[model samples]
Target: MKPEQLQASGRRTLEIERDAFAGLLERVDAHFAEACTLMLGCHGRVVVTGMGKSGHIGGKIAATLASTGTPAFFVHPGEASHGDLGMITPQDVVIAISYSGETAEVLTILPLIKRMATPLIAMTGKPASTLARIADVHLDVSVAKEACPLNLAPTASTTATLAMGDALAVALLEARGFTSEDFALSHPGGSLGRRLLLRIQDLMHTGDRLPRVAPGTPLTAALLEMTQKGLGMTAIVDADDRVVGVYTDGDLRRSLEDQIDLRSATIDQVMTRGGKNARPDWLAAEAVQLMEKHKITALLVTDDQLHLQGVIHMHDLLRAGVV
Candidate 1:
């Protein structure tokens, strides 16, 4: 086939899917709201079930719901007939998906699901099909046409189904007041979790690894501490171990320009007073933002009372993938 023909085929697929999505949006109505309400009010998990291609879409919907604060799981309709129906509880909400609303595997378990009296939400292209008639709520995810040229493949219909599932998940997420922190808890291993939930206390250098010295210590001694700790900076603390100021390589350069004798000058005289500081509980990503805003490489972690707790450097954040 010619390249132009291949391009035309791809364009046709996109146009079909786009129109299908537009149709879904136009069909959104009270049924969608009823489905959301049923799932939100459910005391137990949302049990999603489908057969064949619908099963794949149901699996993704379950995952999206679970991650977005709606507790949900997928059960294959075929398996449900073979005893997996036990997973469904009366307190739970059941979502059944079938483009035709008459998949044999799914329809076979409808009686058992009804016997349990679980709230049923049916997603189907046919609004007047048997499944829709029996379900407590019917969400119409109908598409005008299939993306495939032959009009037989599950293309545009599945896309519409998936988008509708996302709409439910996001709507429920907002209704539940789910925050970024809540999302981070569900995705602790991901980069977004690290950026939102990981704190300075979790990544900062603490205890002996923290570069610190008495305020009156010689500038030369503070430099040695900075070099030994490898943080490129040292916290100048008072007798009570409260940070009074900070000395960094930047201060050392300025002191040299002023021709101050490092061996004789005290840390209190050379240190930058009231330098940027963060709380141990502050998010590491926030600390990174602060550092970038001030164009500094290090920040002393302190408590509300200004007691030194730890030190965070750009290197530490970079190593932790917060940078």
Candidate 2:
């Protein structure tokens, strides 16, 4: 086949899958609602099971559900029959996926599932098939035809199944009032989690590493502290250790423009007073917002009493993946 022919065939395949998904959307009815309700009301985890191509879609659906505030995991139907069924409890809800609705391994476990009185939700192309007939809720994911030219591959049907699974996850997420913070908790090591859940306290330079100078400290001394701390700035504090001002690279530039004597000038004389600051408890993501809003690179972290706690640079947030 020519390269152009291959491209054409691939595009047609995608078009078929896209239309199949649209068909599934139009077919969604009260059964989809009932499926969502069953999963939402489930006190235990959602145990997803399937075979073959449907199994791959089931794994992805389980992951999406788990990450979106629904506790869920995938279990291969064949494995479920061989003691993996122990993972399923009476309190849990079972979501079974099979394009034909009569996959042997899947059907083999239906009796055991029913005997446990576990709520069964089936995603299938044939509503009248045995799996659908026995399910407490049936989500119809039927497609007009397979995307394969031969009409044998599970292409369009699998696409429809995955789309339906996403719809159910999103609906349950909304009904449960699942927030981004909740999502972050489930994905603490991912970039989104870092951006949503990381706080200034987790990334700030604190204690002795926090560059600070007394209000009357000489500019030369403050510059030394900033250099030693490598924070590009130093917080100027009063005798009470309360933040009084900040001296940054910008201040150094202005001082040079004015030919201010670094030896004689004190931090209070040349520092920017009452500059923007953040609380240690503030989200690092929020700190990035503040810094971008002010077009600044660093911020002083303070406690409720306005006492200097630490300092955070934009670089810190970038390294922490909050950017």
Candidate 3:
């Protein structure tokens, strides 16, 4: 094919698939709500199964459901005919996917699923297909035509199925009040997880690692503490260990301009009083927002009493992949 022909083919495929996906918007009717209600009320896992291209789409649907708050897993229809049928229990809900809705592998297990009294949700293009007729809830993922020129491949059909699966997952997610933090619990291995799950106390420096000085400590001593702790700042605390002020490198620059004796001046005399602070329980991502709002790199972690518990820096957020 010529270059222009290849480009035209790709564009046509996208347009067809886009329309197929858009078609699902009108079909999100009472049946869709019923399917969501059944899955939400299920006491056990949502077992998803399909055949061929539909099987691939089923696996993705199962994964989205599992990650978003609904507990679900994919079981191959062919495997279900064997001992894997034991995996489905009466308390669970089963979701089966088939474009034709007459996949022999899927049909073979219907009698067993019915015997167990497990609720079956079928996703198919044909509303009157045997699987749809037998299922407790039927989701119509029908598309008018295939994106393939020969109209044989599963292009637009599979795309519509996947979009329908996503719609279900997101709707169920909202119904369950599933938050980002809840999602992070299931997806705790990546940067997205770190930003959502990580807390200030988890990454903040505490104890000896904290740079601090007595209120009347000399400017040189505070600078030394900042250098030793490598936090670019030192907290000045009262006798009760409550933070009274903060002295950073920026303060040091201003002190030098005033020609204040670094050896003679006290940290309290030059420190910025009442620094921006965050709670230890706050998310590290929240800390990033606070820092950006205040235009500061570090924040002192404290309790309701403003007693210093720890300190967090922008560099720490960067290393933790929360920045």
Candidate 4:
């Protein structure tokens, strides 16, 4: 085939699949809501099964559901006949995918599923087909035509089915009030998990590593503490070690412009009063937001009484993968 012919074919496939999804938007009605309701109320996992291409889509849908607060797993129809059906319990709900609604491998297991009294949801192109008629809820994912030139390949139909599966999972997610924090719990290895789960105390510098100075300390002395701690900033605290002000490198630059005597000027005289602070339990991600909003690089971690507990720098969030 010519290059132009391949490009035209690809465009035609996208157009057909796009139309398939347009049709699906109209089909999301009562049955779709019923399917979500069943899955939401299910005491056990959702058992998804399909054959051939439909099986591939079923696997993706099952994974999406599992990762989004729903307990679900995919089981091949062929494998189900070979005793994999034992994995299904009476409390489980089955989502059977068969575009034609008459896949033999899937149909063969219908009797056993029915015997267990498990609720079955069908996603098929033919609403009148056997699988649809037998299922407790039927979601029609029918497409008008295939994207394939020969009309033998499953193209637009599979796309429609996948979109419908996504719709169901998202609907169920909202119904369950699943939050980003809950999602992070299920996906702890990813960047989103780190941002949501990491706490300020987990990455902050404490004890001797924290740069702190007494309010009466001289600017020269505070600068030495800042250099020794290597944090570019120092907190001015009272006799009880409660933070009262913060002096950063920026303060040093302004002090130099005024030609102030570093040995005579006290840290409390030059420090920025009432610095931005975070609690130990505050999320590192929230700290990053506050830093960006205030255009600051560091946050002092404090207790309820404003005592300095530790300090967090922007670099700490970067190193901890919390940014």
Candidate 5:
């Protein structure tokens, strides 16, 4: 195809789906709420079943629900008769998808699902189809036209189904008060999990690895601690072990320009007092913003009484994928 033809075809396809989505918005009324309520009240999982392209969208919807704090998973309608039907329990809510609403494989298991007293929610383009008539709740995902030039491929219909599934998942998620931290719990291995779930205390270096010095310590001695700790800085604490100031390499350059005696100058005199510090419970991502906003490489983690808890550096954030 010509480049212009390709561009025109893609835009046309999007316009069709856009209109379908607009139509779908109108159908999200009481019936949709009923479906959401049913799924929410289900004691067991939301078992999604579909055939062909509908199955693909159903599987994705199940995954979205599962990750968003709802206990859900997909089952193939084609495989339901082959002992997979045991996966469905009476307490489970089944969402069956078929644009045609007449897929023999899906309809084959309806009697069995009904006999088990399972709630059946149907997502179909044809309202009068057998599957839609049998469902306890019918979700109308009918689209005016397919994006395909021949009107044979499932385009707008499938888009509508996916959007409807997302709508259901989100409604249930909101009703359940699912927070980002809860989502992070389900996705601990992903980047979002790392950002939302990881805390400053989890990555900060503590105990012997912490670079600390007394406020009365000589500036030269503080520098030795900074070099040994390799954090490019050291926390200056008071007798109560509270951070009074921090002496970084930046302070040394300014002190040297003034020709101060590193061996005689006390750390309290040259260190930056009231430096930015974080709490151990603070999110590491939050610490990154604080670091960027203050233009600092490291921060001292402290408690309510300003007692030093640990130290966090830019390298630690990078290693933890906080950035």
Candidate 6:
């Protein structure tokens, strides 16, 4: 095809797929809710199975369900008949996808699934097909036409099926009140998980790693503690280790401008009293918020009695992937 024809073909394909997705809106009726109910009430996993192109979509649908708080896994229909059928238990719910609704492999396993008394939800374009007729709930994913000019490729139909699967996952997600924290727990390696699940205690410098000094300590001693610990600041605590203030690089800059005697002045005289602080249990993201709010780069972690627990710096958050 020529350049213009190529562009036109791409646009035409998108238009067909867009309409295919739009058609699924009205179809998200009672049957869709029933499918969600079945999967929600499932004591075991939601087993999805299909053949060919539908199998690919089934795999993605199963993944979405699993990540969004509904435990699910994809079992290829072709493999199910061979031996994978054992994976589906009586307590499990099965979601079978087949636009044609008569995939021989899928049909071959229906009798066994029926014998186990497992609830079956079928997504098909043909409501009269055997898969749909026998399904406990049939989800109509019919598309007006394929995006393929020859009308043979599984294009728009698959798009509709995928959207329907998303609808079910999201509805069930909300029904279960799945929160971002729950999602983070499942995706702990991802950035969102790092932000939501990483606590300040996980990254803060504790024990001797903390830079601390008594309130009466000279400015030179506090500066030495800051340099030795390399946290860009040092916590000023009382004899009992209760944090009273903090001395930061910014404070040093101000003291230099006033020409204060760094050698003779006490830390309590120049330190920022009751500096911004965070609890050890706070989310590292919350520490980022406190740092941003105060326009500072470091914070002291304290316990209920304001006792110094640990210290966190901007670099710590950056290294922890929580910034």
Q: What is the TM-score of each predicted model, taking all chains together?
A: 0.94, 0.95, 0.95, 0.93, 0.97, 0.95
lDDT, candidates in the order shown: 0.92, 0.93, 0.95, 0.94, 0.94, 0.95
- Report the C-alpha lDDT of model 2 over 101-215, residue by residue, as the tens digit: 9999999999999999999999999999999999999888998999988999899999999999999999999999999999999989999999889999999999999899997
Task: List, residue by residue over 1-323, the lDDT tens digit for candidate 6.
Answer: 89999999999999999999988899999998999899989999999999999999999999999999999999998888889999999999999999999999999999999999999999999999999999999999999999999999999999999999999999999999999988998999998999999999999999999999997888998899999999999999998999899999999999999999988999989999998999999999999999999899999999989999999999999998987
As a whole number from 0 to 100, the lDDT of residue 255 in candidate 5 is: 96
Misplaced by over 4 Å in model 2 are none
What is the Cα-based lDDT of residue 298 in candidate 4? Answer: 92
Candidate 3 local Cα displacement, residue 238, angstroms = 1.1
lDDT of 1 by residue, 1-323 (tens): 89999999999999988998888876678888989999989999999999989999999999999999999999999988999999999999999999999899999999988999999999999989999999999999988889987889999999999999999999999999999999999999888988998999998889999899996787778889999999899998888889889988898899999999877888988889979999998999999999999999999999998999999989988887776
Ten residues in sequence with the least summed lDDT for candidate 2 = 21-30
lDDT per residue as tens, model 3, 1-323:
99999999999999999999889999999999999999999999999999999999999999999999999999998998988999999999999999999999999999999999999999999999999999999999999999998999999999999999999999999999999989999989988899999999999999999999998898888898999999999999898889899999888899999999888899988999989999999999999999999899999998999899999999999999898
Candidate 3: lDDT of 187?
84
- How many pairs of residues collide in each model? 0, 0, 0, 0, 0, 0
Q: Write the per-residue lDDT of candidate 5 for residues 1-323, one digit (tens) a residue.
A: 99999999999999999999999988999999999999989999999999999999999999999999889999998888899999999999999999999999999999999999999999999999999999999999999999999999999899999999999989999999999999999999998999999999999999999999997898888899999999999999888999899999888899999999888898988999968899999999999999999999999999999999999999999999989
Best by TM-score: 5
Model 1 misplacement above 4 A: 256-260
In Å, residue 316's CA in model 2 sits off its true spot by 2.1
